[model samples]
Target: MYRYDEFDETIVRERVKQFRGQVARRLSGELTEEQFKPLRLMNGLYLQLHAYMLRVAIPYGVLSSRQLRRLAHVARRYDKGYGHFTTRQNIQYNWPALVDVPDILDALADVEMHAIQTSGNCIRNVTSDQYAGAAADEVEDPRPWCEIIRQWSTFHPEFSYLPRKFKIAVTASPHDRAAVKVHDIGLILKKGEGGKTGFEVIVGGGLGRTPYIGHTIRDFLPKEHILSYLEAIMRVYNLNGRRDNLFKSRIKILVNTEGPENFRDQVEAEWEKIRDCDIDIPREEIERIKRYFAPPAFEALPGESASFEAARARDAGFDRWVRVNVVAHKVPGYAIANVSLKEPGRPPGDATAEQMEAVADLGERFSFDEIRVTHEQNLCLPHVRKDDLYAVYQALKEAGLAAANVGLASDIIACPGLDYCDLANARSIPIAQALAERFAASGEEEDLGELKINISGCINACGHHHIGHIGILGVDKKGEEFYQITLGGSGAEDASLGEIAGRGLSSSEVVDAVERLARFYKRERREGERFLDAYRRLGHDAFKGAIYADA
Candidate 1:
């Protein structure tokens, strides 16, 4: 984790002081709601239906045990005793008092975390794969580049007021766990002829009202020129991106209007002028950042652990958990363990203050003081020793964080729909809860391997509904809330948007509809085929007929 320096501390303190004054003015009636809207939004405060919600950025989803404890403290003291982790790799506090938000931001700054750039038209959080430095398949760690981009995009005057918000994600693995294809800018770390690192710079991918898989603009850009190349892309979008309609203001729209070739040509022309300018990142700075992410002291041990296997053999619960929640680590004796937040009947990403504190404790004791938040709304202990698997499972089970559903149907991804969001039409949490319970009771989730079911209350796609294996979108028709189902969507290396199945189902019909699709896939699937693979092979009609049988 990158600790804040003197400069970082000073700037965050100054930003908090300025916002404190702005908030005081709003509360004292010196400024109206409309007047204070932009100012509050700039600081990651939103006026939702019931109360103000504060979103705090967790950069690239990496957290030290110390930072995680501070977040737990914030959750306990300031607002409700819980926080909701969002899809963008940030956490949201739903009921913070408007007057208490400044103090919350101050509390966050004390831990070198903040709400800055978590919300706004400028570049949002620079996300990467959770298993960045630890993944076996990584060509290079992508966090240094993400951090570099973070430092560059923070308060850059040129992009401070873009037509729409922009997002950038970096992934070093061939697996594309970061969903780079669906970001405004996506960078894949790759090695060239001399094993020198560079980026496959992708541009224009996004999901909202209109969805797109970002196009690769530069096949290979030198590592040193990342900042300059990004500046060129931002400059091009800022100059020509639409300002008239808020709906079409994103860079994706601009890239679509002008074909990828023309977009690439324009960016290349801009890059030629600035590629070797003073803005280019120096090699020393890159090296300096890289040092912060170097591997921790990993002891050499055998790949097969006798104690670990013996413990799993004794306990059925632990054995099932190990099968679903544990993954192979780059290091021989260590394993990557996922702490599932999707316990049946709870909101998918909600972690109580006590649970957060427990997780921090687990990370410190068993995982080399490091924790990561997964894009699937789970917490990961990235470097847990294989020998301590049973003890870690026991700790998690006691804390109510030990569900064994990682990629199963029960491990659902859902947004705060009508329950918390004013923009929502139907309720997503209930639909997700209903489906998870339905699957759990039938014991069918384990059989339906690697199914991703994502739900969004509205078309804004905050839940990433566009990329789920089974995507559920909440729609309002004749003032009634209905759920639409889509199949064949995936957010992997072969990224593809889901297609709508048929007519939207009523709220009461949602769970039954999802179960029908599951049954259809199970009947049609070949050996070891995932729901996505089978959906692609069988096509949408096979599942669509199951759900729309009455229609």
Candidate 2:
């Protein structure tokens, strides 16, 4: 993880002090609610449906054991006993007193964390593949670049108040685990012709009311020019992106209106002037940032651990957890273990204070004292030893953090919908819960096979429903909650936005509709076909007919 330097510390401390004064002025009745809105939002505070929600940034989704422990402390001390991990790999506390926000920020600052840029129209937290350094297929760790972008984008005068929020995601591997295609700006790190590293830059991708896969603006951006190129894109959007209409304010709208070719041309014209300016990335700085993410010390061990095998054979639950939760690591003896937050009926991506502390302890004891928050809204111990897998699994299970449902149908990705979010028109968590329980009860999860069901309370697509194998979007119709389903979207190398099936379903009918769609896929799929593959083969009509047949 990137440690905060004196400059970083000073900036955050000053920002907290400023926000404290702002809060005081508001409380003193000097500032009205309208006057205080932007100030609170800039500090990552939101006045939600019931209470103030504080979104704390876990930069690039990396956390030290100590940092995780502090988060647990904050959750227990202020607001509720749990915090929800979001799709962007940040965590949100849904209930917090307005007066206690500064204290919360201070507590976060104590661990070198903050809520800065977690919200607002400026660049939000720069996310990346959760398994960045640990993934076996990675060409390079993407966190350092994410960190660089984070610093550059934080409080950037030019982009501080954009037309809308901006997002950036980077991935070193060919696989798009970070959902780069759905970001405002997506960078894929790859090797150049002479074995030099560079980025494949894509811009204008977003999901909201108008979902779009990013277009490739630069096929190969040199490593030294990343910041400069990003500046060009931001400048283009800042100057011409829609400002009159909130719904069309995103860069995606601008890109759509102007066409990608013209947008790319404008960016290139801007880049020609500022390409070698102050934003040019220095090699030494890159190396310095990279040093923080170097692999931890490891001892060479046998490919398979005998004791681990013994525990797996003896414990059926442990075996299931190991099979689903653990992933391949770059190092042979190490594995990336996903600590699932999606357990049966609980809110998806939520971890209790105790569970968070337990995970922190487990990371320190069995892994490398480091943790990651995946884009799928799960926590990860990215450098666990394969030899200690069973021990870790047992510890996680005891903490109510062991769910063997990674990438499974029941492991749904959901946003804090009407339950918390003010922008939401209908509830997403309840629908997610109902569907998860339905699938678990029907024994359809195992048969569904690697299905992703993502739900967003609204069109903002915070839950990334646009890219799920089965996407559900909640809308309000005449003050009633309704859900519309989409099928066949993916966020990988062959990324595609899902197509809506047909008429929306009422909240009562949603779970049944999803069940019917799943059964249709299962029955129609050829041997060894995943839901997505089958959807691609048969198209949305097959599933649409099954869902709307009796309507």
Candidate 3:
């Protein structure tokens, strides 16, 4: 993890002091709601349906055990006893008093963390593959680049207030765990000719009322010139992106309107100018940042853990967990273990303070005192010894954090819809809960095989419903909640936006509709076919007919 230097520390503390005064004035009635809106948003505070929500950034989703512990402390002290981990790999406190925000910010700063750029129309927290350094198939760790971008973008005067919010993601692995294709700017690290590292830059990808899978603007951009290229893209968007209509403000809209070829031409033209300036990070600084993410010291051990194998042979539940939650690590005898936040009947992506602390402790004891927040709203111990798997599993079980449902139907991604958000049309949590319970009780989630079910309260796509295998969008029909379903969407290397299956179903009918679709897939799928693969093969008509067969 990147530790804060004096410069980083100074700016964070200074920002906290400035925001403290801003908050006090608002509390004293010196600032009206309208006046305080931007100020509060600048500091990552949102006035939600019931209370103020504070979103704290976990940069590139990397956290030290110490930082995780600090977050647990904040959750316990300021707001409710839990916090919701978001798709952006940040955490949200749904119930915080307005006055205590500064204190929360201070606590976060104490651990080299902050809420800066977590919101607003600026480049939000740069997300990446949660298993960046640890993944077996990675060409290079993308976090150092993520950190470089963070240092470059934070409080950048030229790009601070874009036409709309911007998002950027990086991935080095071919599997696309970072969902880079759905970001405003996506970078895929790869080796070019002469084995030199560079990025394949993709632009204009986003999801909201309108969604796009992004277009590859540059086949290969030298890694050294990443910032220059990014600046060029930002400059193009800032100059021509729509300012008159909020709906048309995003860079995706501009890219689509102008066409990818013209947009790429403009960016290339801008890059020719900016690339010669002093925008790129020097090699020395790049090496310095890379040191912060070097692999941990490892003990020499055989690839297979005898204890892990024996335990798996003995315990069915533990074996099931190992099948889904554990993944291949780059180093021998190490594994990347996912801690699922999606327990049955629970709101997806939420963790109690206790659970957070427990995972922190587990990471310290078993992994290398490091944890990662996934784009899927889960925590990961990026470097756990295979020999210690059972002990870690037992501890997670005791903490109620052991749900062997990674990538399953129950492992849903849902936003805080009408239950918390003022912009929401219907409740998202209950719908997620109902569906998760349905899957769990039937013991069909494992059988369904690697399905994604995402729900959003509105068209904003906060839950990333546009990319789920079964995407559910909540709609208001005559002031009543109706859930719309989209099928075959994926946010992977083969990224594609889902298609709506037809009319929206009432909240009461949505779960059964999903069940019907699942049944149809199970009955019709080829051997070993996942839900996504089957859906793609069977086409929309198959599932659409199944869901509406009983309608």
lDDT (CA) for every model shown? 0.91, 0.89, 0.93
Runs of candidate 3 with Cα error greater than 4 angstroms are: none
**Which candidate model has the greater lDDT, 1 or 2?**
1
lDDT of 1 at 32: 100
lDDT of 1 by residue, 171-267 (tens): 9999998999999999999988788879999899988889999899988888889999999999999999999999999999999999999999999
lDDT of 3 by residue, 1-551 (tens): 78888999999999999999999898899999999999888778898988999999998999998999999999999978899999998999999998789999999999999999888899999999999999999999999999999999999999988999999999998999999999999999998999998999999999999999999999999999999999999999999999999999999999999999999999999999889899998999999999998888977878999999999999999999999899998888999999999998889999999999999999999999999999999999999999999999999999999999999999999999999999999889999999999998898778888999999999998989999999999999999999999999999998999999999999899999999989999999999998889989989998899999887
Compute each candidate's TM-score over C-alphas.
Answer: 0.99, 0.98, 0.99
lDDT score for residue 372 of model 2: 91
Give stretches of model 1 more than 4 Å off.
none
lDDT of 2 at 152: 90
